[model samples]
Target: AGGISEALITTAAGLSVAIPSLMFYRFFRRRVDELVLNMEEESLKLVEVIHGEREPDRTSEAA
Candidate 1:
């Protein structure tokens, strides 16, 4: 019985921090991945426009 309750309390406290820490880590990791993918797509589009492989969008010019 020695230190049984204390050990459990410590374990629970560790999980309280660890669970949310892991969740936030995954959340931000996914967010960063999405952003990087978007940036890559946008950069490809820009490269196409710069190299005359694709026509430039003219909506902003008309606006």
Candidate 2:
């Protein structure tokens, strides 16, 4: 009986630490995804502008 209670206590403690860590990990992961997407969009825009300036004729080719 005592062993079971002690094990339960340890399980509860582990969960207490794990739940918040998991939540924080997910939140940061989402933020990173958003940032990466934003960077990708900006880079694509920059590339398009540069490419357009280099070749006005091929602007239609981009589409």
Candidate 3:
């Protein structure tokens, strides 16, 4: 039979691991969302350039 100390230690260990794992998961999730938004914005700019709706940026041209 497990004693109170075992139960408490298990609970504490689980929480310690879980909290950081959850935080990292959320951080990466937000980063993925930001990357997707950036991709969409860049793609739209590409479409505009191809269609002659807008001029390509001078900075990009210089590069």
Ranking by TM-score: 1, 3, 2
- Model 3 CA deviation exceeding 4 Å by range: 61-63
**TM-scores vs. true structure, each candidate:** 0.84, 0.79, 0.81
Rate residue 29 of model 2 by lDDT. Answer: 100
Q: Which candidate is the best by lDDT?
A: 3
RMSD of 3: 1.9
C-alpha root-mean-square deviation, each candidate: 2.1, 6.3, 1.9
Per-residue alpha-carbon lDDT of model 1 for 7-63, expressed as tens digits? 999999999999999999999999999999999998998899999999987775754
Model 2 regions more than 4 Å off:
53-63
Whole-model lDDT values for every prediction: 0.94, 0.86, 0.94
- After superposing all C-alphas onto the true structure, candidate 1 shows an RMSD in angstroms of 2.1
* Candidate 3 TM-score over all chains jointly: 0.81
Ten consecutive residues with minimal summed lDDT in candidate 3? 54-63
Expressed as tens digits, the lDDT of each residue in 1-63 for candidate 2 is 999999999999999999999999999999999999999976787787788854334554655
Cα distance off (Å), candidate 3, residue 25: 1.1
Off by over 4 Å in 1: 59-63
**C-alpha displacement of 32 in model 1, angstroms?**
0.6
Clashes of each: 0, 0, 0
